[model samples]
Target chain A: MALLNKDGSRLDGRGVTDLRPLKITAGVLNRAAGSCLIEWGRNKVLAAVYGPHEVFPKHLTNPRRALINARYIMAPFSSQEEHGRSGPNRRSIEISKVARHVFENVVFTERFPKTMIDVHMEVLQSDGGTRVSAITAASVALADAGIPMRDLVCGVSVGRVDGKLVVDLDKYEDNLGESDVPVVISPRTKELLLFQLDGLLSKKEVSEGLDMIFEAANVIREKQVQALADKFKDVDSGDLQ
Target chain B: MILEEIKEDYIKELLKQKKRIDGRALDAYREIKITKDFIQNAEGSAIAEVGGTKVLAGVKFDIMTPFADRPDEGVVMFGSEFSPIAHPDFNAGPPDENSIELARVVDRGIRSAESIDVKSLFLEEGKVLGVFVDLYILDHSGNLIDTAGLAAMSALKNTKIPKVEDGKIIRNEFTGKLKLVREVAVTTFEKIDGVIIADANSEEEVASEGRMSLSTSSDGFVCSAQKSGKAGFSKQELMDLIDLSSEKSKELLRHI
Candidate 1:
């Protein structure tokens, strides 16, 4: 298959379980309490954390717990094919749900009673696994905002394509793949925050994919910590603001 | 942009000193801020901020059959939208003439300059073209034409085409720049105190008799010009405005 090279490998020259090169930027938003931009392969997203402040649109307010509102928007011209309309589509809605689930695990909602925290993630580009990348990046952004959290949440996506297992599928691979499993894990407690899959996978393959994802998530979690420490190192707390 | 009567009066008072509400000269535009390669999914994308006005433009190049009439050249289509989220008065649904005019100004600016090599868009003779320009307005403060043009040109300037080899496409993470032959300039005119002022805001637009827009290049070539309102300008007035626009066009090019 053209998807595989002469050596029976993916075209990008990676082992089926390996990830593409990763680049990240923290504290990208000037106005947000916390923000980050993560580029995983070609999938790009900007995530911003807005509160621990007042909650607007009164009725949706939670009296005892802080509300978490997350919106994921794909720009109108993000794809080669015309998207026709801009704003939330079905895919975006699903991503939003998955993102909220991931953050809810790490964020300590009880600390801020009756308040709300808003997380907005904008997908500037999509290669594949945008939801997993957004969840991972937004967790770091929330921490960057200095919001109280239990443990860092790290998300990774794994998939089986063309009779082989792969992690962090790029756009082309994702488009032609048979199955994808995205999982968000809390590294410290080993808890599941978000779990989702598209396409079909046998029970054995699903379990294997889950194990691979959690292992990857642990490694990614450390990187998120290092990214923050590197930024805040030798700087005063006021500089963080 | 809702303003109290006093605020409107305050704006007029500032205009007496040729000042703007945002502390700029009447003829001066607000600061221009640009972000290129801002969108990852889009082939070419940029966001340009002109003071409070913000526009995001993305260019997506697709391989498709060439038009019957323009078999050798690539097709260029400009899509513009002013959302209600940007300004309170802008309504949703099909665009109005005002929005259409904004798209045309940007279209003319890019087309007249031959910014995109139309021939580059062709894959086979009379088959498969490679470029499309999509422009969107995210925020509207004032000066939509200039802001839109800035966004479109910058978006085009920043765009890169994906390489196709052996009928297999490889999506590269980085982008290459577009081919721009020359830069075009756009200037909006408002008649204030029987004199034409450049780059009017919504407030001045409401109070003025009529407005005209002039777009030109560095070499004093007119690319596009449009007039609005029932009031007409004298021949001499047109010449003076053209002279004013010519100088202002060069200045506008600097911001791009």
Candidate 2:
């Protein structure tokens, strides 16, 4: 199957550098202290934040600073073909651990000693680039939860499809394509938070993919800020109305 | 829980005039949105939203041995996961009773309605296909049973039977769409202050005295019914609820 058309457009009829349709909605869930719903192509991810509260299992608590407990879960129904078993599987566990590490760098954990901030990212629908989307949404949720952070984390996945470097890979492109590189960076400090490369890529390709991802991340960062603004826009105007 | 008491009183006062806190009528439901093929990795997937409550259902297939008693039949299994993201009260652990009950209720609705032709999934005497329907509660404002049930049915309806060659399942190859016999929809009714309401939010759910869910087919047959909570309903009330559910099922079925 051709991952790209003869003209270098993807199977989804987008240019190699193009991204899937992106929409981010913040504060969608009422129960969570902070919440965001991200629709990136067919991927539907929800991120929620709770606490700055006490950490259970005393041994796991860090007395000197707050601990970041991040979980990334793929709903069994989130996929198109297979029903994933519920709970933290090996893949989710790894993702959770890495996500926690990524957020730890941004969140000022030392401010809330002996407390924990829980970040939960639920993938209701999965296409591709879910991990990156989850991180993007989780950062916004953290900010919405009133957690002070060095900067918001923005992310994007760049992949080599049909031997061409593409900015964002959808399910088909990600699976059928040759290589994938997902990266997350703090838009403010220009610091890397998460970076992973899967499949084959030359040194030049990796450099090009990073450049593409960085550019795409800036666009994503704008959307994230706008989503947060949209969420508070109502409240901001409520006082005047 | 004390906040529930205050909200319960307010809900009861609102019920006196047949009004809901969200401004819905006594039998009114929140706006429902269903998007099929929401996930790309599953054979079929759908997201169902009823008000603030959201549920995603995905259908997957695997090859398995047929039951000794039912050699020519396939299997349909239902599982539910209530993620902590949906509500603060939900924990990350094994499926609790609420999850199991929700899955069973949704499973019963599909199974009793004969929504999928299980016998068609039988590949050979010993080999059969097993269908798994997984529901994930992404948001839990209230009325999860009904929303999850609808999502499950929708995802199942959207399912395609995967191709199998020489007992090996091909991941990317699909044979054809699954044979579906009927369309099912579940409607849940909650009793508060002696009045029945539809699509209750979390606040209303806490205030609710009794809850009843009825799954109806497109042909107007009640496939399954479940009742929960401490309160009970009168015979007339039960019949009225059935009538209301059947009517509402028609509206929901349109979305499917």
Query: Which model scores highest in lDDT?
Result: 2
Model 2 agreement with the true structure over B164-243: per-residue lDDT tens digits: 99997899789889878988888888878778898888899999866777777777666666555534444346567667
lDDT of 1 by residue, B90-139 (tens): 88987665676677666765666566788866667645546667668788
Clashing pairs in 2: A79-B42, A80-B41, A80-B42, A80-B43, A81-B41, A81-B42, A81-B43
lDDT of each: 0.71, 0.82
DockQ of structure 1: 0.01
Chain A TM-score vs. truth, each candidate: 0.92, 0.96
User: Once superposed on the true structure, which residue ranges of model 2 sit more than 4 Å away at CA?
Assistant: A1-241, B1-5
Interface RMSD, one decimal, each candidate = 28.6, 25.6
The alpha-carbon lDDT assigned to residue A139 of candidate 1 equals 85
Residue pairs in candidate 1 whose N, alpha carbon or C atoms collide under 3 angstroms? A124-B40, A125-B40, A125-B41, B64-B128
Query: Which TM-score value belongs to model 1?
Result: 0.48
**DockQ in order:** 0.01, 0.01
